[model samples]
Target chain A: MNVAKRNNVTVTGQRGAPVVMLAHGFGCDQNMWRLVVPALAEHFEVVLFDYVGAGRSDLSAWSEERYASLDGYARDVVEICRELDLRDVTFVGHSVSSMIGVLAAAREPGRFARLVLVTPSPRYIDDGDYRGGFSKADIEELLESLDANYLGWSATMAPLIMGNPDRPELGQELTNSFCATDPDVARVFAHATFLSDNRADLAAVAVPTLILECTQDFIAPREVGAYVHAAIPGSTLVTLDATGHCPQLSAPEATAQAILSFTGAAP
Target chain B: MCRTEQEQEPERAGGDGSLTQDAAFTALLEDSAVDLYENAPCGYLSTLLDGKIAKINSTLLAWLGYTREQVVGRMSFTDLLTVGGRLYHETHYAPLLRMRGEISGIAFDLRAADGSRLPVLVTSAVKTGTDGQPLLIRTSVFDARDRRAYESELLRARKEAEEARREAEEARLRAERERERLQNVLVTLQRSLLPPVLPEIPGLETSAHYHTASPDRLGGDFYDLFSLGDGRWGFFLGDVCGKGPAAAAMTSLTRYSLRAAAIHDPDPVTVLTTLNTVLLERYTGREPRFCTVVFGVLEPEGEGFTLTLASGGHPPALLLRAGGGAEYLPTPGGVLVGVLPHPPFTRTSTVLSPGDTVLMYTDGLTEARVDSGRALFGDGALLDFAARLAPATAKDTITAVTGLLHGFGDGLDDDTATMAFGVPASGAAGKPA
Candidate 1:
């Protein structure tokens, strides 16, 4: 597939501006960036896209073998850059997408110049030596809840934790999109996200990175953000006053300012 | 109307009789409303915006065996759930209710006063004020012991279904193993039906090859050369009508009958004629068997071998002469054996000089498909091939023909049988010495 169509890529910014590719997390589509994209689009060329199984992407292109791991997602990132001939790209990834950027940049460090990780966690379950802030049984219960209600659990859980009841549109939109994802794809994606162990992949990230850590995030806790910052070379960690995992929704202005500040100071 | 004391009491209490009746009715209605809420069959509770219990009914209190004072203002709705249920309530139930403004039919287990778990289905809604701000949450609880028991039945059925699927898989695998074992048996059977080893013929170099298309069944093609007494030898190649166990039986009968009949006469025509009579008598049943064959008798001569061959609906033998000439030794007026009671058979006579090869093959080679299944390797191609290999030895001719068959690849789909005989030249002389 052509690069633009495969990931539902949409490029909009100044003609000669640097490319800012925004990759959304697992639960929602590219609509996850609706609040943050408007500000970033003015200063840099912002690229928004949905993963293959999440939004208006071509589902026929999905193969169980090809998408069995996160490496396939990284391959998509590399191909998108190659297809568009994008150089010195600034990749911004949220939740599970953050590690996807880390993996892509590690493989092709020449293509990327900066990495911005929003609520990133290399692993969710805690092992003996490392503290990922969640137990195995906790994750199993989360999966069982997903199996029981699919979108009902995430759509409702995301908004309450995200805490934007004043704006009902955000929660309602998320609920509809939760059911919109193919349940099979969502289940596989959950396994890839929560069961992955990519702590070693952080050392190979040569590009300057910015980690956006939010307060009170039940998904990726504050310690995970610190662990990511310590592992990535020459990486900066910015703890936002935003309360939830998605600062882009709960606190869009702060999220935008932090990103703009990082890119300006990164070079 | 009867001036009863109960009726007069209301009039006595208030100077206006209608006012007294209104006062009495108001007290009665207020008492009934509170009683209905307290003793309703289901449980009812209200929580603050922060999930702290603000008001609870006596019915829910009775189900939990908790006093109203102990539950109210002390515990949130999540605190009343079991440990696992609490996690679910905090993660999914509460979030969904807050975002959607309501949730219904959620299954949860509430920890009772004595720590026994009570299964309940809860429905909750967020209460909003005139300004559309959520003030509190109102929840109704229903006992779901029966529903829980019923849903567990599906689990049992699912386990049974899983067990059934595994057994079906095992049966399929067993069937596959049986098929493999049958193929092995057929391979051994097919090997035994062919000649154990080609008999050594003095003064004549001989070689033969057989190819079967698939491993699952035995081919009908057969060839053998056996010695006849006093410097004479009998050789034959034939293809039975069909394949498999039945065809193999017919082949064994024909091979043994030819050997027996040839021993009695040794002439090519008499040997085939004797075998034909036996087959006609044996196969006269409803399902008859027939074949095409070329039987030959060879006699030692000075610096050469003389061959007399008889045909029954078979291709003529090809002669690769020592002088580099190759052609078919035509034998005419032949018919298929065992089908007719008096099938006319014909014979041909030829001589194999030193370094000359006589090649006989079943129709499998000449009639095979060669060019991308688009055309057959017909009689013309075989003629050209024999001419190319003129003056070749028996071993060399057989080897070259096998190579040609291998090159046919996917196009050659049938089994083939071929045999060649040659008289070797003496050293220091290419021609007969």
Candidate 2:
């Protein structure tokens, strides 16, 4: 559970250069960057650490009272940047971590130079003017499934990943990683990631940004990624031919190349 | 599936095309009824008017762990409920549903096959046909396990918050009560240090008043008037350096010592010197306590009184002349008592003519703060107040100063003690000009 500690940092291609801080999403930790790091670390100094409750990080730091909201996670990101004295950081975020970084960068604009959002979503529940993939009733069914098979969440969630699965076992291996997290911690994080709405913060980002969209994703669809790009000022939108949520694991070469070209780092 | 095909075969034998279509539609309706009755999410059940179970859907039957033959004719709907749920159904649920012809979302419990209780919400409605006659009762049921859990959590949080709030309020109340008790003890001790009514000195109108800034806290002011030997009167007013029960104890000692010393020698200087020795002996420890007192002895003279005043670090007395002039009767070279072995006590003699008032007050009056824009109501303001009513009696001066003390609003942050003795100007004691 020492994932909060920085294990290894690679700065292969450049010295005394701008930093690229990568924050992972709900289930996975900093290990999600194993494939993309070898390519981007050749040019930029890659900073990685797990969220306190995720992976092998310190579980004692996760407090139900304090971490009841996503703001606690976002504040930790800002404090970590301050502790490392990182400036002009090109923040790379995946899944729900994208909004976490967006909030952190909005709170302190001077710390972050740019943002590379991967499969970002603002509001997952649709209002009258919005159309998220699932309806409220569908989400209720998902909650019921979670409660019914409290022990078999991973086995059930794997098959529900995509409608057309050319790689069915890929979803199973990815869900196997999800089951590694403590069920209680996973439950709280599930509520926090799905229930948060940061749509208002999309326009306030004053940094250069790039948003990578999956062509076929059940969670964050192409329309949703396009909407995020439209709301954020001066942000570029790039689409990749990946299907599943863990794009770096599904297609690492394309994801790393996009990050390198957007950051203008030699790879 | 075979039964459905057998039922649809006779409909295909009809020669007319429209008749054949009607027969096929009837077969489709029957198939949909089986699906709806078996797979519906809500529990549907029917009971006789007397509460006997007549028919039930597959959902309700599966929930109760009973087959079609077990409960259809043998038991009533109340048989599936727990003891308390059954009682409520009879007393509250049955009567309300009967009077209203419908009742919805009434929470109850049902006993399952394994004797475990199942929480459920039920909505029962009396099914009536075309003639408006009461028929069988149809009820819909929903599982309430999740709602009940949520409700219990909300109740727990509410009870915890209420307990925390009550504990905080109790602490505040105890603090307030302690302050009130301290103030009561101080007021009782202060009264014991002064005479109830200033000895009814002949040819003299004497009056005294004490004003407290806060009734729930103690103050350090003291005053008294008592008879010396051979028709000479002794009086003193002083303010201690601190507050609470300690100040009240010192005020009592000072009042008694001055009264006893003045009997042997009615000179104000000797009376204060005796008090100084008593105070210095009583307070010999580190951080010794002390006070400022002004002692006076009044003796009858021609058309006026001879007043000898002695001060121990006390303010000068204000002497109001009969013809409307006010000035401080100076008694200099006085230091606070109890700080040293021998303290210098200053004595001065002044004759108050008839119809003149002498006012002795604690510094609380001079140090009172008023409006935000003005300076403190200082000694100059008090002198001007005394001059405005020069031709007033002792009672008039005392009453006027008491009203002035109240007029300070929240400005008077300490206790005030005032005593005035003089001959009356007119008929009544407090009849103002």
Task: Tell me, by TM-score, which candidate is best.
Answer: 1
lDDT of 2 at A172: 49
Per-residue lDDT of candidate 2, residues A52-154 (tens digit): 5654444556777656677877876886787678799999998888999999998888999999999988877787787666555544434332332222234
Candidates' C-alpha lDDT: 0.79, 0.75
TM-score of chain A of each: 0.87, 0.82
Writing each residue's lDDT as its tens digit, candidate 2 over B22-69 gives: 678776776687778776897888998667789888888788888979
TM-score of model 2 relative to the true fold?
Answer: 0.56
Model 1, runs deviating above 4 Å: A11-16, A152-180, A242-244, A265-267, B1-253, B256-433
lDDT of 1 by residue, A1-267 (tens): 665776767788765798889988766667777778888888898888777766655565666676668887788788888988888999999888999999888878898999999999999889888888677675565554344344443533442423232344654554443334555576676677778889999998898899999875767789899999999988999999865567776567889889889889222
Model 2 chain A lowest lDDT segment of ten: A1-10
Clashing residue pairs in candidate 2 are A13-A42
